[model samples]
Target chain A: MQKQENLSKNQKIILDLIEKSSGPLKAYSILFNVKKQGIKAPLQVYRALDKLIEIGKIHKIESRNAFVACKNSNCQVSKATAFSICENCEDVTEVSNLKLSKYLSNFADKSGMKYNKYNLEFFGLCKNCKK
Target chain B: MQKQENLSKNQKIILDLIEKSSGPLKAYSILFNVKKQGIKAPLQVYRALDKLIEIGKIHKIESRNAFVACKNSNCQVSKATAFSICENCEDVTEVSNLKLSKYLSNFADKSGMKYNKYNLEFFGLCKNCKK
Candidate 1:
């Protein structure tokens, strides 16, 4: 693969965490795991995570207070807002399917409401996490 | 409506709050509103809410720390787990479509994993919240 944007040591570690996770992961787990690699302090990881989220390099699983890599980096996923999560596998996947997004978009247009943010979630076992 | 289980005055007030809301509500907002109605202790409301959630009387919007009454009280919805939520109007909806439910179930069967609890969320403007 073409070399993705080079990241600092901290970012690289976080990226690896998302890449290797069985499913989506919460921030606390990231904080705990990063320390295993010798990164110190609570804020350093979150700061790096925040930056990762901002650049669309990663996505936050809003319901679980966790982060996951955007399955499709080129897709238009927004980190500042909300998205769906799979409960079983702990994998946070993007919910940008055209049908669902448009269904919700139509709802917003009719409501005439402006919110700084919003959330949508579906809780269930994932394709992998299910029993 | 067949009189559901009779509720204490505090519980009754909470039901009314859910009934009148334009969308789902977080626990803190319920506490504030209950207090406005003269329920003295904060614990009383949460205690009631906890039970409401336990007995499948109300659904928790995990992403937003909020609650909504089950639109279909008679449906087999579980209060112990997660479900989809609408971010726009704060409405919580169930994602029990047979196709999706089976999709997740098969994945879990293969993974051999179990979680005491899980989260599933979706974020977007509602049919009404989209301007």
Candidate 2:
């Protein structure tokens, strides 16, 4: 994992906000939440987010255009990451199963193509949402 | 699979453009490509896209904010879908492996949450791009 000390001031601020959220946070929402901290522009937020993502401190939920802090300690080195998303509640849970990650890393297509990185998002009703 | 005859005019026009593409097509790109076919507004294209996605005629590449035609005959009924994306070339290929789909459909997390729908996007250099 990349050392936390390497994060810039803005990156740390944004990452902290994401880590505190119960669910994923969108860029605009994050910007709004951090405005008091002197993050006045969207580009500042985006640049910090891009850096955070590069260091594996945060991940973007592509489907929702939201960001979430990486939950797994081993996630920085893992080539595959998966998330279970509740469509109704908008809750996102990162899957950290070693076996699952191994299976996906070794998976090959008909053309025998192998992938170096993968993001899987599963959509369904959460336990509470199903009730 | 949803019958092709069930598609509305605008849906058909947008679907054809997506299907004919070598890679995924974004909503605005689809609208631009079909403007001569009478698709005048972004909402019209989005509405048709939502319907097409609902019926499984096309699948969205969440990371790229683009849509691609489902290449597998069995894809309409499958609960899980996976794509291998070439990061360098921006090429996307849908993975239609029965075994992979089955494995994911049955996958459970630590809380024993099983997903009804999943979309996996793998990123890597394609065979041609690697050379």
Candidate 3:
């Protein structure tokens, strides 16, 4: 596991907002929420987001262009990620299945390419939404 | 297999541009390329992209915010997708491994949320980039 580093003021502020949210948060939305803290620019939010993502503090739901807090403390770096997204409710959950992560981490292709990172997203209806 | 539907003028023009490219194309880039062909607005390009994606004619590399032509004819819909992306050269290829696809397709999570779709992207150094 990578050692946790101290976050700057802006990163901490933005990350706190995302971490507090029930679902993923978008860049603009993050900026809007953090403006009271003087993080007014989109670039500030993006820089914070990029840093947070690099340190495995959060993962981006690429399909939705939003960010969610990383639930697994074992993931010190955001290299291999999998999420289960509810299509109806837009609820996003970080999947912590050992078998799935292991299978994907060890996966290789015939392209002769050395895979170092991967992201997988599964879409479905949540229990509540399915009811 | 789902029957192929006829593409409108805008759709055909945009699809042709994306197909002729070696790598995935972004929305703005697609709009720029098709401007001479009368696709002057961003909405036009997005509409065409949405339709192309719906029919499995193209798949979006969400991480990169680009679209690539689907090589597998068996994928009549954009429900399941997997891609191998070269981090160094940004080269992207659609992975057609049957076993991998089947494994992912049949994968059931403990969430009890029936997954109907998934997208996976593997990042690595391509053959040429490794040299």
Chain A TM-score of each candidate structure, as shown: 0.71, 0.92, 0.95
Q: Model 1, B22: alpha-carbon shift in Å?
A: 8.0
Off by over 4 Å in 3: A1-5, B1-4
Model 2 residue A16 CA deviation in Å: 1.0
* Native-referenced Cα lDDT, model 1: 0.60
**What is candidate 3's local distance difference test score?**
0.91
State the TM-score, rounded to 2 decimals, of chain A in model 2: 0.92
lDDT, residue A84, candidate 2: 90
Cα lDDT for residue A63, candidate 3 = 94
TM-score of each: 0.57, 0.94, 0.95
Model 3, range B94-124, lDDT digits (tens) per residue? 9988888899999987888889999999999
In the range A73-94, model 2's lDDT, one tens digit per residue, is 7566435778899988889999
Report the backbone clash tally of model 3: 0
Candidate 1 vs 3: which has more TM-score: 3
Give lDDT: candidate 1, residue A12: 80
Candidate 2: the clashing residue pairs are none
Clashing pairs in 3: none
Best by TM-score: 3
